[model samples]
Target: MELKVSSRSHGDHTIVTIVGEIDLYTAPRLQSEFTRILDESTTTLMVIDMSGVEFCDSTGMNVLLSAHKRLRERGGVLEMAGPRPAVRKILQVTGLDSVFTIHEAVPEELLAAEPQA
Candidate 1:
């Protein structure tokens, strides 16, 4: 299924909420969204709200890794929030769970303060 992505800015971060299956066919869309957010905004953090994600594959993992790498290069970070069971398992099985910061939800404290541009 095609993925749906919507984003909002929180402090120095951008929270992108994604829904649908994340596979080879749909990963590029997510990648583009990340590229756009990173290029167009003064965001230092990217939070992926994966609560609605029904599935995730290697392609999806690659997309996340790429974003993480890009952000880290700029001294930024990528966080994954509220992933479903299947998606979480994929991350765990691939030993990628340790690679990202996982949250139960968007950290309200992070949203309360916007970093200087």
Candidate 2:
């Protein structure tokens, strides 16, 4: 399956919606999208809506971690929203569940109102 990414701005944040499998072939696509968002300077809060992702591999997790680290370095944040069960489990097993601020779903304000820790 192919990876698909879409986005919308929520005030000072951007919500990126991703679908399909995220593996070796698709991780770059996601990384590219993140680069574009980071370059555009529209928001500092990057909310990834993974509700449509069916599978994610180690590469995918690496991509997420890289983005999370980059955002944190700049005093920004990377958040996961509505991750599928498998993806959630990977995050838990890898101890990354604590690294990211996760939400059951993308909240109304793109979670900007909440403190980013």
Candidate 3:
């Protein structure tokens, strides 16, 4: 489908809304986007908005995992936002629901999350 990365600031954190299916074809692009952001050293927290992702295959899950792993090692964190029921089911079945921080698409006070040092 289509992907849109919306950047916003909540205190010192950066939120990016990802709207699309992150399959094999699109995963690479998303991966690259993360790498670029990481290199910039401007984003301390990355919130991937999965609210618009209608379908996600294993490849897509892997993409998210890869990003999480990378961020963890780098002392950063990547969070998931607004996953639909289908996608949520897949993540829960795979036991990734516990690993990732999931949030509803609501108005929350985005505090300045700490960066990995």
TM-score of each: 0.91, 0.89, 0.81
Model 3 RMSD vs true structure: 4.8
Top lDDT prediction, candidate number:
1
Comparing 2 and 3 by TM-score, which wins? 2
Residue 16 lDDT in candidate 2: 86
Q: What is residue 58's positional error in candidate 1, in angstroms?
A: 0.2
User: For model 3, how does the per-residue alpha-carbon lDDT over 1-117 read when each residue is reduced to its tens digit?
Assistant: 776555665554667667777777787777777777666665556787788888888888987888788878877788888999999999999999999899886326563343434
For candidate 2, lDDT tens digit of each residue in 1-117? 999998876567878899999999999999998888777765778889999999999999999899888877788888999999999999999999999999999986645664566
The Cα local distance difference test for each model comes to: 0.90, 0.88, 0.76
Candidate No. with top TM-score = 1
Better of 1 and 2 by lDDT: 1
Q: Using TM-score as the measure, what is the rank order of every candidate, best first?
A: 1, 2, 3
State in Å the error of residue 108, model 2: 2.4
- Could you tell me which residue pairs clash in candidate 1? none
Q: Arrange candidates, best lDDT first.
A: 1, 2, 3
Error of 3 at 117 (Å): 31
